[model samples]
Target: MILLRSGAFFPLIVMSLAFASLVLASLVTGAANVSFEDLLLDPEGSSLLLVSRLPRTLAALLAGASLAVAGVIMQMLVRNRFVEPATTGTGECAALGLLATTLLMQNSSILAKMAVSSVTAFAGSAVFLTLAHRLPPTQPLLVPLAGIIYGGVIGALTNFIAYEFDLLQYISVWMNGEFSGVMQGRYELLWASGVLAVGAYLYADRFTIAGFGKETATGLGLNYKSVVVLGLAIVSLITSFTVLTVGIVPFVGLVVPNIIRRFKGDNVRATLPLVALTGGCLVLASDLIGRLINHPYEIPASTVFGIVGTCVFLWLLYARPQRRV
Candidate 1:
């Protein structure tokens, strides 16, 4: 118990230190260099600090936290830690929703696009769940594999539409995560993810129980179906908001939760804070590195995460024990 608690608590501390460093890095290092003294005294420096870097950092923090939490919830509900929104079709569905709305409405507002994308994402999740429930128990991996295939189908459809309508460039732009454009008015959409995160925290215990198996959860007097639906809804909402705000971030969700579990065990409630902290730190670090590495022309944060997370995921595939059914 002591060792477990120590390990769990240690990551939170490390993440906090990392987060602080990233924040300072964001403030100190940018396209235009403003000295500490100038940043402290100059009105224009202060405006840049408040208007630009601050919102970017907050967006990164919120996006990371939301994606990580959504990944945890999806893994628990599906009982597969390897599963995430990217793999399970939620991101693709949201992108498809955006594409459909763009094609149909031509010039819809971001808010309308978000609403359409969120609903489409939720519907995709519902289909996945329904199919999983109907699949034979002997083929346990079939469901998630099906989700991947389903996502591929949706992605192909999205591509077809984008190509046909000559909107491929627009699609590509929104498909990659970028923090560069985040400003004060634009970032309010991310607050939806924050609200969903709070909902996840409130229902954390039910999720933990649901992971034990539907029958067991039902035996415990929990409304298993409702809980599953609610969790999926929250996951869809977070994924949609994330895609809307900064585009699709691939594996922060998958990587962060597994890393947290290494130190914190598998208790959802106990691990939530660690997950949030690690996610925020990882995104912040990636954003800072992306900015500094290219100087004036910045790389997207998702690209950095993709490179790092892919290597980590490959290592985990070989190093970790297979999950028991």
Candidate 2:
């Protein structure tokens, strides 16, 4: 416990420092090279800074934090460290909803598309939870495997529809993660995830107890069903908001939380704040490196994360010991 707490606490401080550096880098290191002097001295430059870089940095931080928290909550709820919004079909459902809105409505705005996407993603999460309830609880891997299979089916259906309708390009652009386009008024949807993250912190204990098992949680006087539903709802909201704003940044929800738990233990309540901070730092770092590596071109933050996370995941798989749960 002492080691875990120490490990958990120190990373938060480091993450905070890294986050600040990344934000500063994001503002100054862009293609235009808007300096601090330009931001302070010129009105038009100041507006550009506020309108462009500030919002994008904020969006990246919020998206990272929200997705990380959602991942932690989901791992607790399903008792599976590998499970995440993307793996569980929430992202695909959101994409389907957005695609449907664009095809059916013909004149739907981004907000309208996001609203529909959020609703559908919530429904998809509900389906996963329901399936979880019906299945005989066994190993943690089985639960996430079910979710992965479910998500795969949904994703395939989505791809088929997009192909049939000749909207593959639109789907392709939206499905892959990209932060280059974020600006003021465009990334506000991510604020919803911030709200949900707060709610998750408030109910962290319930989630911890619920993770012990439904019967155990019930015996402990916690409302297991309600807690599970609340956690799922938060995950759905976070996932949908992220998909709508920056597209799918896969493995964040799955990888970050698991990595945190190795050092912090499975104390969801105590670990959430650190998870959020570390997630933000990781994303910001990835975004900054992506920008610098290609100089003027800029790689997607998601691509960086994917490469880094896959390696980490492989290491974990190799090092992980078999356990009796």
Candidate 3:
């Protein structure tokens, strides 16, 4: 494996430049006739750019970065490289929360829905962690397999409830991640997820320590439980916000961080920024490809990433070395 040490200046520069290029591509690649001239000269006059393109691009970037960070946080806390928020019932529980809010408080505001989703997501994550603790530590791969099954059950429940109430369409919006509907006013809530991702960086050292196991971290004077709670909160809130805004973009959290950790190592403080940028680049590039692949018709970013993520996941599962969590 090629190990690139974290905090390297060159990698950051390259990733930043690639991210910028993807953002520009996302801004201009749509059904509307937006040009570099229109972007540079009449930036505000183009309703498509102002109303749709910019918002969608921002949403993609925010969701990607936040989810990738959340994934890193999850892997750190769970000590399982394969685990992520989506696999561990967090996203499914968020969908359940959204479904409940839609059914009960049909007139509730978006913030209200997000609050409910965050609570449910947190509760679900806590449950998963409890189950994880019960699993034999020697079987490292079992954690992710259990998480996938746990998430599947919650997702099945959410789907059944949504189908019963004729809200499958509503639930599907959160189940699948996409950015086509994002407009200026509709996507600002994702900024909170971006903030929370940054917040996670502040506690990166604690998380890295926590990954060494509760006893070790506690022996070293870390507040193990407090750090776990904080990590769960960050993961849940980020998941809720992204799910509500752009749907659940699967494999972002699963694929991006593992790829980073594989080469960059797990120094959260040094590698966190690169993980966030690479994630944003992945989602924005996926979004742009989805838009251009079908021309006037668009594929969801989730679909594009699903194919890519699955391939990478298989490669990781078979080709890479596994570590005990």
Best by lDDT: 3
Lowest-scoring 10 consecutive residues by lDDT in candidate 3? 1-10
lDDT per residue (tens digit) for residues 240-325 in model 3: 99998889999999999988887778899988999999999999999899888989999999999999999999999888565635
List per-prediction Cα lDDT, in the order shown: 0.85, 0.84, 0.91
Q: Predictions ranked by lDDT, top down?
A: 3, 1, 2
Error of 3 at 215 (Å): 0.3
lDDT (Cα, tens digit) per residue for candidate 2, span 180-245: 999998899889888889889999888889888888999999988889778878888788789888
| Residue 164, candidate 1: C-alpha displacement in angstroms | 0.8
Q: Evaluate model 3: give its TM-score.
A: 0.95
User: Model 1, 64: alpha-carbon shift in Å?
Assistant: 0.4
Q: Which stretches of candidate 1 lie over 4 Å from their true place?
A: 1-8, 133-145, 321-325
Under the 3 Å rule for N, CA and C atoms, how many clashes does model 3 have?
0
Q: Which window of ten consecutive residues has the lowest lDDT sum in model 1?
A: 316-325
Better of 1 and 3 by TM-score: 3
lDDT of prediction 1: 0.85
Model 2 regions lying over 4 Å from their true place: 1-8, 109-111, 132-139, 320-325
**Local accuracy of candidate 1 as per-residue lDDT tens digits, 1-325:** 8966757456566777888888887887788889866777999988888888788989999999989999999888887777788878899999999889988987899889988998999998888777666877677668667878988898888889899989998677667998999988888888889888878988999999999889999999999999988998998888889888888888988999988786567889989877877887898888888998979889999999999999988876678654644
**Per-model TM-score on C-alpha atoms:** 0.92, 0.91, 0.95
- Can you tell me which runs of candidate 3 are displaced by over 4 Å? 1-7, 43-45, 321-325
